[model samples]
Target: MSAFDDNPFAESAGVNPFNDPAVTQVTNSTVESVDQYNPFPATNLASQTTPASSSPYQPAVLQPSSEPTPQATATAAQANLLRQQEELERKAAELDRREQELQGRSSTGKENNWPPLPKSFPIKPCFYQDFSEEIPTEYQRVCKMMYYLWMFNCVTLFLNMLACLAYFTTSSTYGVDFGLSILWLILFAPCSFLCWYRPVYKAFKTDSSFSFFFFFFVFFCQVVIFIIQAVGIPRWGNSGWIAAFSVIKLSKAVCAIMFIVAILFTICAVMSIILLKMVHGMYRRTGASFHKAQQEFSQGIFTNKTFQSAAAGAASSAAQGAFQANN
Candidate 1:
């Protein structure tokens, strides 16, 4: 009727395209699947509405470090000092051990051939050994003082030679003193170095009683020499008080020079005495004794090839002589 009112298909289907029963069933199934996987659930709405500061999301506050107190700083310094002291003691012990090993090697008659020298070389290179390095820390200062004294003595001796020369030029009578001064310088200089200085060095190095006693005996003689030199006896090589006054009548300039040398000699003597006392105290602490010295001397004597050879020769001669006499 209105366009033949409706076809038969149009009458069966709805006017809207979406009104198809198949499409409606598909839409309902898709919505049900989406609802099963909803990301923002409604139960968490209350937590999301709360302020961040009032919630568990607040940042942690940082605390500033406090300054150390005076007492704490002092304690730290003391601890550092103690650690340093311990390190020094450890180093000292290590050095002592090295010294002992070196001594042991020396006593065994073994030679160190490091950096081997050419056979054609005239002098053997023994420069690697330094006995001074082996001196103990407690005695190092005194040892250095002793070395300084030796140097002073050498200087004084040299100056005395000059003073004596000056006096000889002024007065022919003083020529003997000048000649003797030369001889004294020659003899005492090397002798003192070999006898007292080396022995003291070895004593401190090895705590050897023989070296200690040897040094003491030799240095005692040295002290006596200093006194005699200071006294400036006539015909003596030293330019002492007597020489200075005796030459004053000849030349005031020469007298002044001699007096100055004498003063230096006297100072050296006084210093030597003081240093000797100090060294003696240190020696006592080392427990060096005459008994130990005797033992060392005996050992040294037995080890000496010259002595052994001489003894063997003497014994053989005596045996031969006795056999001949018996025959």
Candidate 2:
């Protein structure tokens, strides 16, 4: 009865489950581990918080920027502008120098070479002539031909004088022809050069309508004179075909010479006609007109220093006379 009445799960007062050898061993080990383990250690905390060096603490300093400053950038831009301005000024100076050189060459720099006389000779060259420099390439051929024609005419006149001298030896009545031949040579050579040749040269150089018109008038007269010389009129100071034929009875040499002169005159007339046509064609292409020529003539007259001085003097005299008359 006593054994059945006692509970099977009742704890025994002296027996503790926690006081068992295995449980006591586990509790002792856990207590020792809990004491040894520390979440915050002195060495690890110091390594994390402190710097590697032993130097004193200082404030952080900012390094200089690699980018250019505003002032520096502005200075660079100004320097570039100054350099450009200097370059422009240098170029302007060069252009001015070139312009001055051109003006000098065009006006007074070059010396006269025409009439090509020696330095030791009494007479100096009277004109400057450079077809290649002053005249256009298209007009050079015509200009040179005209110059050659002038030279040829001079030669013909000299030859005519010789022929006339020979004829004079044949008869005293031919003295007038010899004298007139000398006169013609002396008068015509310089006059032709000044009147027709110079006018044509200036016309080509400047493309002046006034010069062109002047050349046409003078050269036309020259052509007519050439035709008259070719006609060989007696006592007219010409060695024409008739004069040449007449001289044949006197001296065959004189006749031959006069015939050559007559032929030269005919050639001059024919060449003048052809050249006139050519010049006229060129003038038409140049767009020059009578109105332009008139303007140019008037302008030239007004701009002439001699004309201006004369006009001023005349006005002054007229004013003085009127004032005296009124007084």
RMSD of each: 20.6, 15.8
Among the numbered candidates, top lDDT falls to 2
Measured by TM-score, how close is model 1 to the native structure?
0.60
- Runs of candidate 2 exceeding 4 Å displacement: 1-108
Q: lDDT per residue, candidate 1, 204-230, as tens digits? A: 878899999999999999999999999
TM-scores, one per candidate: 0.60, 0.67
lDDT of 1: 0.83
lDDT of 1 at 54: 73
